[model samples]
Target: MKKLFFAAFTLLLSLCSFSQNYQLISGDQIKVSKYSSDLDIVASDKTGNYFAEQRWSWNLRAKLYKFDKNYNDIYEKDYRKELRGSIFRGFYPIDEELVMFSTEYTRKEKTFTLYARKINKTTGEIKQDAKEIGTFPLEDKRDDFEVKFAPVSNGKKLLFAANVSNKDRVSLVTAVLDPQLKREATATIDFRFTPKQFSIQDVFYTANEKIVVLGKESEETQVGKRKKKRWVFKQYILHIYTKAGKKEKEIPITADQRFAISGKLIEHTDGTLALAGFYATDPKKKDLSGFFLSKIDTDKNELLLTSYKEINASMIGQNYTEDADDDNDDDSKKSKKEEKKKDDDDEEEEIPNDYVLKSVLINPADNSMVITAEISQLYVYQTQNRSGNMTTYTTVYSYTTKDILLIGLNAEGKVKWVNSIPKKQQEKYENPNITRSEEDYFSGKTAHPYFSSFAALINKDKLIILMNDHQSNNVNPEYGHKVKRVYNFKKKSNFYGISVDLVTGTMKRKMIYDNSSDGIMMPRSAYINGSTILIPATRVKMFGKNELKMSQLTIK
Candidate 1:
């Protein structure tokens, strides 16, 4: 009997050891300059080869790296001399070629020109000649200039659009390019709204070879009876245009009596449109109470299916408190009773605040969808100082990114399951030094920008989430207790991998590795290539020597 029991226990241990369905491979460390701290994966090819852009702290020029299938760095190219006075836009894979985009502003002519050059994917050699994509005249050299690129038809075609607003109206210079970097069509389209009241949010190339532009428009209106008047969001608009820049349809999306705080538009394969977002009933409050999904019949100008799901406390998981140890105390029991009574007196359900929908994944086979949202908030603190006649004001911003919410929906737009993964992280940045505006800070201009968020991928039947967490979280693998807050990701932080069963919403978590001995892994820089996820890790030393490596996680 003793032998049988021992054998059974051994088998259980082995089963527990093989629970994780993935393998992590850490590549060899390579010495890099101290200024190169962040790496972003720009593009990947069909054969599992990828390209990364290494950013420097001092300049806009970046180094390009080409990695092989096994995460081996095979080629490197520096762009400092080649792009001396130009701003690097991005590197993208259009069709079978890797294209690099850069912009040059000629102060004499007050013109900003966008140039695109081809790069050899395997050799990392950039072509000397560049093709001019667009040119815009600017009133001032300091004015903001941006060019938007959208890939369509499984990356077989590219769309470029830029705002060329004038005094009277807002206009966009749009162009469509084929795989060979040849312009198929170019035209200027009017937005029909003033620049101050409307802003373009996103551009999409539809499945039927059409252009869809999403814009947000705001207007001022009276709110209260007399003196409490204010302005808020008016409506969101969508303009659908043909490939030749002819406007086909203009649709305005509005929530009945409620404010649509945030939303995302999705284009189906059959030329249908869907909208998903969060909503708030009270205009005075920014907290969202429910989420809605709607499918639209564009031709009929009506909604085919609309579903609204209220987010309650139970959907966000139990609120675990640190006072569990004090449960036996009399005062604690009394306090809990009073809190419970107060909760019972209130009729409104507790809901999550500052949650933003991040990504929506649609399964190709059945059209079932999974949506992911995160709690992101920014608090600004101000301080004033007086030195004789000179008065100075300083500002500091505290950024918080918390729990991740996952919701699953069937093909008919019905909610199947909902789950929340607990996590807490905070990052602080001071003004006048690092960033000039909140938008710049949110764009990752601060130090240690990629340490706070998570990277996620949806595999065949599972949703995988990778994040840097506090070391103590490994003690309770079931995630029953309150998540320990990680103020900063450092060497002591542990990298965690969570796998969720898509159908049942069941989750399993494990600490994949610790950064105590290796280095700090940036999860936000992770990208999926085929069945593998690649992340960049960096270790900075006291001097100018730094070590960089690639970590790959392959789903088994």
Candidate 2:
């Protein structure tokens, strides 16, 4: 069946028409603000109780939202004054107390200081009586620094990875902070850099307490050299530290070719690290070259499994040829003068089909990790005559394309297997007529491009996969067109969710979210206890959006 998709956002114009609010009843969730705020939600404990957050502002404040087991808002307080620092980074809820640290920059002395605090669960929000302790910023110029927390064998401790000194080589500094907010700063773990190149962008910690550093480096050029130049690319370095802050072992990447990089690290109970990120090829190889990566590694830095295999895009490009020809017609045929003018004025190359293809849990396992990515396709094609011979001269066409990437690494980092969700098997193989013509555009089919958003849980023996399909502003918003050409794709938002068996790579029946007359469907949020699920939901409505509500779903 052919479906209509458009952006008839004629009514959602009023700003006060802000969307409704939702709270995950069974999980620790914080409603930042009714309209806009820096942080929607950040750190939450395993049991889904107490959660800490960093407000999004230039001089933002850190707040804690402790919800009762029933999901009632119990306490709301601020901690900006307690730590007495201009800035704060690492934070989360723990046990019966809330433990967090602070870092500040002393502009006058050009120095940095770190501090910490342990508040009772009932401490009441950021009170004047709230006692504070521990300085983490280490009285030096920690120009480039970051702090994080991880589960340590002896107990949970803070892991600070920053520079040892502004003048010294950049190092990964570690400090252990327990529930009591006690500090046992480990010796600095340094990540060696290239000659005259030293800087780290960001870092993450695994369950086993190993650290993965991700960032780029740059080198200066000499005056008389083969033209001074500047190049930047991402690099990865792995490190394990002792309780005293000394290095236990280090594994560094030896890829001679460096390109821009951004990545995340997750820790597994079986002591392995799951890494998910994307890389690009040279600008000249844009068409013949694209990028894709999926890998699992042991805690010790051994490559467990990887899917960097190239995706032959020949089929995709060929589809563009047949489709492109449909744009021109015999009625549009031009005389010699008209044809020659059209050829010379033509600047836009023949565009190719762009797909944001991805998958999850390629190798499902009890301890397998979930990795998701978005690969954007951008391509162009041009034709050139092979020879100048009048009659035998044949023309050939070639294309150039670029891939933009975005990745999300699960909090725990590892999953049983990545669900290899396939792309649409050519148009005919896909559900019929999901695409429609653009009401506001020239002659061309404006497909309702789908962005697959998923919510997954790594349970004891299974990987619960909740998938949602969104039209993501793919087609143009329908204007005042009679048939809602542009408006066709506008309100076409239908959501779907599913459950999967990680060990067997299997899926089950699903849930669908429908839209309303006002064009809204805030679907429901979910929580998992053992194998049971309690979902806060909104039922499908015929003419209006559903009321904010809740329900339960059983997976047998």
Predicted model with the maximum TM-score: 1
Each model's TM-score, in the order given? Answer: 0.80, 0.53
Q: Model 2: what TM-score?
A: 0.53
Error of 1 at 433 (Å): 10
Error of 1 at 394 (Å): 7.9
Question: What is the C-alpha lDDT profile of model 2 across 1-556, one tens digit per residue?
Answer: 1111211111111222121111222222223322111222323444334444444345546676554444455566677566454565545444345555566666666656665555555644432342233333434544424444555532355445444434445555655556665654545555566423655544545455545554445445432234545432324444455445455555443232422133445444545555544333432122423233334443455533343433344422222112233223221232324334544443221111233323334223423434444333211222333455544422211111112121222334332233333211011111212222212111111222222233355454444554333234222112221111111212444433433444454544233334333222222134444444444323323454322222223333
Candidate 1 lDDT over residue span 194-298, tens digit each: 766666766666666566666777665564346344344556677777767788888776556565666677766665778788776776335666778888555
Off by over 4 Å in 1: 1-19, 32-38, 46-48, 54-59, 164-170, 221-231, 268-272, 283-285, 296-305, 317-353, 379-398, 429-448, 475-481
